[model samples]
Target: MRLALGVQYDGRPFRGWQSQREGGTVQDELERALSTFAQMPLKTVVAGRTDTGVHGLGQVVHLDTELERTEFSWVRGTNAFLPQAIAVQWARPMPEPFHARFSAFERTYFYVLHVSPVRSAMLAGQAGWVHTPLELDAMRQAAACLIGTHDFSAFRSSQCQAKTPLKHVHQIDIRQHGNFIHFRFRANAFLHHMVRNLMGCLIAVGRGRYPVEWLAEVLESRERRLAAPTFMPDGLYLAQVRYPEIFPVPAATLTSVPWSAVWSDPASSS
Candidate 1:
């Protein structure tokens, strides 16, 4: 039987999501924990692989296992082996056809930026820092060009292994609450560093370093060099993944995250 697991992590301590020979990644730790619990090596397929310093609020993974256990047992048992930074949030027996990555229809990500001249010690690694003020209107106008289907080649990283650069960006919402700027991106799929690359450009426009039209030009140029440098991963979070109704994945969103109390989902419609 195939088992699906919901996971959440702080991500600061992990090398990244993917497993490596050094075994410092979130996947490596998770697999090791699962192996110990099952008394057999268990490999898992993730819905999305987040980079180092990028947190996971609603990440999903699936594993094929013959081990039968209650859902609560799976969750509590797995948590018993995991570090404080990571934990299995929920688990369910999945239909054989429910492949984690392939079955996902959409993904949502959020970036939290602390806008202050002097960084807050409390939010050090929890958020990205910007020393100056940004024009929210400018960022919104520039981000508007990203909505709809398009080839996001310019925003893709050179190391990205995705088969195609084309992606559908369903929605983007930029909001500012006091000293923080929150960016929400919902897309069919994101290329490696795509959101970070887009963030850099949008920030530039907000800072008046470039015009709103520049983002459109960069998109049309399809040249990675034309875009701003990729932003830091510390503030990035894999907020949610949407799958077909056949699965019993939870629908609760960004509201459940630790940061939600301060940086909740935007009130506007997508």
Candidate 2:
């Protein structure tokens, strides 16, 4: 039988999601735990592979196993052997046709930034920091120019392996909460470092380093060199992945941070 598992992890300690021969990745740790629980080697395929320093709030994975275990057992047993920073939140028996990656119809991400002049040691690895005061309206204007299908070559990393730069961006929401700013992005797919790259440009516009119109110009140029440098990964989070209705997976829970309440209020500043 195939099993799908919801996973959450803090990526500060690992070398990204994919397993490496050196074995310090989130995938390696989870596989080790699953193998230990199953009493046999087990492998998993993930919905998305995050880069180093990027966090996962609701990562999904699928694994095929012959051993039969109750849903609760799968979660408890696997988590028992997993590290403190990595966990199997939930598990369900899935049909053979269900695939974590291919079945995903949309993905959402959040980038949280500390906009204060003084940085907080507590949020060092959890959020990005910018000492300059950002103009929220200007950032919103810049983000609006990117809300559609476009060849995003200027926003993707040179190492990106995607066959095409074209991608559909459903939304780009800019919200402010006191000293922090949140960037919410929803899309069909993302290229390597795409969000970080875009964030770099948005920050430039926010700081008045570039005019809002410069964003559309960069998009039309299709030249990576024309865009700002890729931003830090500490603020990036894979917040959710949406699949078809046929699969009855639970929706990802949002973080209970004080700023999260703003997400549900349509009247809140954006």
Q: Candidate 2: which pairs clash?
A: none
Stretches of candidate 1 exceeding 4 Å from the true structure: 252-258, 261-270
lDDT, residue 149, candidate 2: 95
lDDT of 1 by residue, 33-83 (tens): 999998999999999999999999999999999999999999999899999
Candidate 1's displacement at residue 245, Å, is 0.5
Return the TM-score for each candidate structure.
0.96, 0.96
Residue pairs with backbone atoms closer than 3 Å in model 1 (clashes): none
Which parts of model 2 are misplaced by more than 4 Å?
256-259, 266-270
What is candidate 1's CA lDDT for residue 32? 87
Tens digit of lDDT per residue, candidate 2, span 78-112? 99998898878889898889999989988888899
